[model samples]
Target: MLDFTNASKLKKIEVNYQYDKFSWDHPGSSAQLIRDGKPKDAGMVEAPLNEIDQVIQNAFNQKVMPGAVVSVTRKGITVKEQAYGYAYRYLDDQFTEADQPILMKQDTIFDIASISKIFTTIAAMQLYEKGKFQLDDPVAKYIPEFAENGKENVTIRQLMTHTSGFEQGIELYKMRASREERLKAVLKHSLANPPGSKYTYSDLNMITLGVLVERMTGQRLDEYVKQYITDPLGMKDTMYNPDIYLQPRIAATEYQPWTGRGIVWGQVHDENAWALDGVAGHAGVFSTAHDLTILGQMFLNDGKYGKALILKPSTVKLMEQNMNQAFPGNDHGLGFDLNQGWYMDGLTDVNTIGHTGYTGTSLVISPKNKAIVILLTNRVHPTRNTESINQTRRLVARQAADAIPVAIPGNKNAWFAGYGDQKNAILQAKVNIQKPSVLSFLTWYRMEEGSDIGNVEISLDGTTWNELGFFTGASDQWQEQSYQIPEGTKFIRFRYTTDSTVNERGWYVLQPQIKTDQKNIAPEFTSTDWELRNR
Candidate 1:
């Protein structure tokens, strides 16, 4: 094993980045800690916990890494914290022994892989408050070698935004053994595309960032983070290079024949991070579900956790604000990935932000809904080819979201598009009507882009279906839609359709009204599948 004691011997470089405390830039000091008490009424009744439990149990039955830990929080209340299946069923190449699996528990520690980047980003932002660095500074200014191979213009912001034009990463394991050689190769590597011209997620961006932090402060990445972050947050179980005594409590991940390591556990799983003696930027941090709940709550509380102040409210705002708008759907902030639908699922909304790890871990925080959900699993255990656990991620996120009621009680009844792989759930009402009638309702929806859709149609003679309009976008603020009821219309139908793929956030229609002969009449909206919801 490479000596980790030589961290101080790493080359010292000039720091180019600098931060200024401009009046407009100050998001002000962090907000007060908001402690979670008993579950407060947020209008939501019950979380769809049965669905989530079923998903995890199904994963266990399917042999998807044997076990997992899922935690869900909504409106400052801990909704769910449960463990499933086995933590370790086997240590060999295959899970051969069926009865030897280690039982999973709620408090098992997990290697959070790429999710560690969020911690690094948080640490960097803390230093920024101390006037350590400006975001736009050139990488070459701090590390002179980064100027090589047409990379002099790469800025700190680009690295965080994932527009640094770097490829995924260099296989340092296949290259020479020295850390400096691998780092130099990384800095000097040619760009696959022009900087800021595109967004390509890469490990090199955060790796170089780890290097920059070291260069600026002469502190090891883990040490700096521990002192400024985890310790303050009281995340006792979150750290790098966890003690030998904690190994039994840690989830096992991967059986790596490629690295000649059998049953990789306790240590960092990312090869590049392992090359750096388990202290790299892209991955390395390990955490428990309970500790992550504290972290997520801190973010929701605007960077304050209990008595410890980690970041300013303004800094957290800046981190959640989109910086990769030019890349459209790839919404991102300084360090957090924003609006990712793959794992975030129903949790993704206007202010949704979080990160995912390669070892079947996910974190989603929705500021708009006052929610946070974490799913940690050792999906790579016993083998790396195990199928993805994305469905489980989506299922848990959706369950948490369902806890937040979308019902509007005052309306008595608003059309509720029950969330599922709905093919075409139509709501139709038969009513006595004349020429020049008006069909109106308050409508809001978050339909799946280009896949799921909602359509409004009218049947004049109650035989032929005529398309009135279709809704295919999202809105944080509700919208009002009105359709002119075709003359001599006897029936109206609100058709909400969905694919067998991802489900929509489901539509909400309030105040279904009809106007006939100068009379605005409240008519019963008939439904075959859609249900009336009272918020």
Candidate 2:
């Protein structure tokens, strides 16, 4: 007696704060294990598991650095946590007792640099949630001094989204004689672009935000962050200034020529932030992999932890929304960078959010999938000539993405069949049906020039082919097209023909399937061979 009608639906559980609020210390339940029996094994990711080790090994092998730290989590489970290589490479070469190799640890503090902006943004958003300020409110409303230099109307949202039109950067470390002077310089600076007309990523925007937070809260940026965000969240290792006692454990950074700062170990690396005494909204925060993972997970949980609503869900959504639509691929969300495929390759979706640091650190959060990847590296140590770690970032994220299985509609894997080489003939595929049925085909294709044409065809026999439709394949973007099969056709085949000798990669086909049930008849194929020819 099979009781098919009484099958129960799965229950949803709330496990947002199963781990600690301030740190990733909670070894929460595994997201993969929980979903093992689901229709699509979404939990299974194909990351090399050992790829983190390979990245570390290659860094040292290439002499890019001596060590690095990596952490990844999905849904609430910490899938990978690793530290590789020596924390102090110069010590290994010296051979002295005090210069012995120091292995990197899970809690190793990294000068996260620009990745700090996310935290600063979170703090600002917290104030916004409290009604301390509205996003479109003029900056002069909070800091009257900022009204100087015809910049009175710049809104808080503009600063958060890098649409303030301020200059890209200022060498405050070189120009200002004092911290007050530096703050004054930022306030008085005028627009480089029209406000909100374009996205010009400016450290000045965040630096101005830091000043605004102070003016509104009557507190230093670090003090404000500690009281409201980190302290309540339990991120003890996160701060603008690392305790002197922890200096020995901090990873080293660039040895700057300015001011003869020998080796920037355990200190803020940004010159302007250093001039401000190691506290700025745009940079100068130090934290660990464990601490950052907690922050990332908080966002994954929709701005809550253990019954505490740190941010309204709507607010978090606003933070993740892409505001710079004018700039197609340059995705920017309020205070957070979004959809950056170069570093966020596998981790990016419409809701994927994260930021990168100039000093070689990145945090990617996928709220839709509940995944996070944290990579910390001292790529600029000893010198800044090391290779960019963007490829490694992409590989790690791609591995995580590959692990999540995609659910096909009919429990059948989709097929992509297409043809076209650079030179002569066209590339195509064919399908045949004996009676009326549903046919669906989708292809993401592009070509080199305007003459490039790739088309779809349905034929009855192997000899003669009839065109179902034709499309200009020269779209700059991957375009999708579909067609239906007519009744009483014995065979159907698809063909892709390119018009010119260009570097053509053809098209990517997805989920091509046919439904045969007559009662559930598929959509009609309005095109006959003659109609297609006439068109």
Q: Residues 1-535, candidate 2: write the lDDT tens digits.
A: 1112322122222211122223323334211211112212325544445555775676678776666888877766677778877555552222222345567888889999999888788888988888899999999988888888777888999999898889889889987478888888888888877777888888999999998888878899999988888887778899887888897688877767674686677789889999888999899899998788778877876676554456766788899999888876667888888877667664555568999998888899977567788888877776666777776676666566545433332344333222223333333334456665555554443343344455555555656655656554323232334455565454454444444222232333444456676433322232111111100
**lDDT tens digits, residue span 338-402, model 1:** 98777777777647899999999999998877777999999988776877787778778877776
Model 2 alpha-carbon miss at residue 375, Å: 1.3
lDDT of each: 0.78, 0.67
Model 2 lDDT at residue 291: 82
Worst 10 residues of 2 by lDDT: 526-535
Clashes of 1: 5
Model 2 scores what on Cα lDDT?
0.67
TM-score of 1: 0.89
**Candidate No. with top TM-score:** 1
Residue pairs clashing in model 1 are: 18-134, 27-314, 407-535, 408-535, 409-535
TM-score of each: 0.89, 0.73
